[model samples]
Target: MDTQSAKDTVDIDLGGVSPCGEVIGDLGDDDMVTVLTGMKLNLAFFSEKVANLRNFVMHLETLGVELEGFVLDREDNDVDVGCVGKFLEFDLLCGVLGSEVVELDRFLDTLYAEIADAGERVTSCKPWQDNLLDPEQCLKQSEEQFSEIKKLSASFERTLSSYKRGGIGM
Candidate 1:
């Protein structure tokens, strides 16, 4: 328990949960480094989920446009149950990400109004991905969700970037 020991520096408790959500453990400096690296890896996982969301939206658009064409020209893609399922899945994902989007938007709105707000260092993460594989295209489909999500994503990223660049200070 001496501060000279590398393990003493981090105050880790493998036996109990810390207020920060990390487990209390006898962590050495090396272990702390590993934890940080793991956190960075988790961030990559979040980015991939975001990309998956993007990919899904693209398919949704494709489906919607194709469905619209079908409606007009009698091409008939909606009669397929699978397409409906996929759209439903994207809707659920949208709900999940959109909640975070709302929170992020609000945080930015208030944060930006501050005269000396530090740019957001909030590290958001998606804990899981769930819902829908119902496809109508006879193959992987995501165009309908793609178009819808792309707009929200663009707005989110633009605002985030502005915050990063000291928009609050301006």
Candidate 2:
């Protein structure tokens, strides 16, 4: 196709609010490809990250429970053998770890719901002549959804770092 005709036909108006909530204009084939590809990549990354987080949470919970049991199994007289300090340490650690694990589980639930919603939107879109689907509403919804995931991912990373630094209460 000629450049002019291609340009004219390629323009797709997804008409919606911008990332900053302002009005948006037309999106060309290139723009659509960028958005679509970005959404796809975001979904993949988000899924993997969530999976890793869930595995980590599970491991931490199991270790926390086991540590609690071990501490409880120690007799009172064992404190003189340095078990007292160990028990106290495990008690505080488990409490903090348990709360963090709960928070992570809640985050996973919310993230999974958002991912499902985005997947539904993507599946609902019908393709154009060139086999590209660029529903404006879906793109906008996806952009918003992706933004949320990015924010959540950053927050999770910060929390993980805090934990590494022994800031379990974080």
Candidate 3:
């Protein structure tokens, strides 16, 4: 919660001992690699979400559907169109997106909370600054990206939820 403290930063310390046996630096390559891989996964996952959002938007336009409208069978995966990502609990968010979704109105608020939680956890990312690969810098950037994704995801979720809850399509 305290994002400003040093302890809250990305913990990518790859420290090693000097001739005097003092820990002089960090071994941060692992952290850098992990951050990079995580970003790629985030990108792909968000892409699916954006796609699904777009499809649902199109469906709304085509049917003049509004939120609170009668929804067809959510059991039909084909109706659950748009960007999909797994929602990780201090974990991963992509696989969760694949689950069958029902009740978009109630679900959007939950999705927003999930993204916000990711933003908080990533804010605590801590990688040492001196590494040649600069995992700390990578963590900073990744956190920013996660924050952005959270905002966008929350927006789409709400907009789609509103459309679903409206009775236009009914």
Which candidate number maximizes lDDT?
A: 2
Which of the two candidates, 1 or 2, achieves a greater TM-score against the reference? Answer: 2
The candidate 2 region of ten consecutive residues with least summed lDDT is 127-136
Q: By descending TM-score, how would the candidates be arranged?
A: 2, 1, 3
Supply the global lDDT for candidate 3.
Answer: 0.38
What's the true lDDT of residue 88 in model 3? 13
For each candidate in the order shown, give its overall lDDT on alpha carbons: 0.40, 0.46, 0.38
lDDT (10s digit) by residue, model 3, range 55-151: 5445433332322232433332333322121111101221122231223323444444544443433432433222223433443444454445445
Q: Which candidate is the best by TM-score?
A: 2
Off by over 4 Å in 3: 1-20, 23-129, 168-170
State TM-scores per candidate. Answer: 0.33, 0.39, 0.30
Ranking by lDDT: 2, 1, 3
lDDT of 2 by residue, 43-74 (tens): 45545545555565455455545544544665
> What local lDDT does model 1 show for residue 83?
37
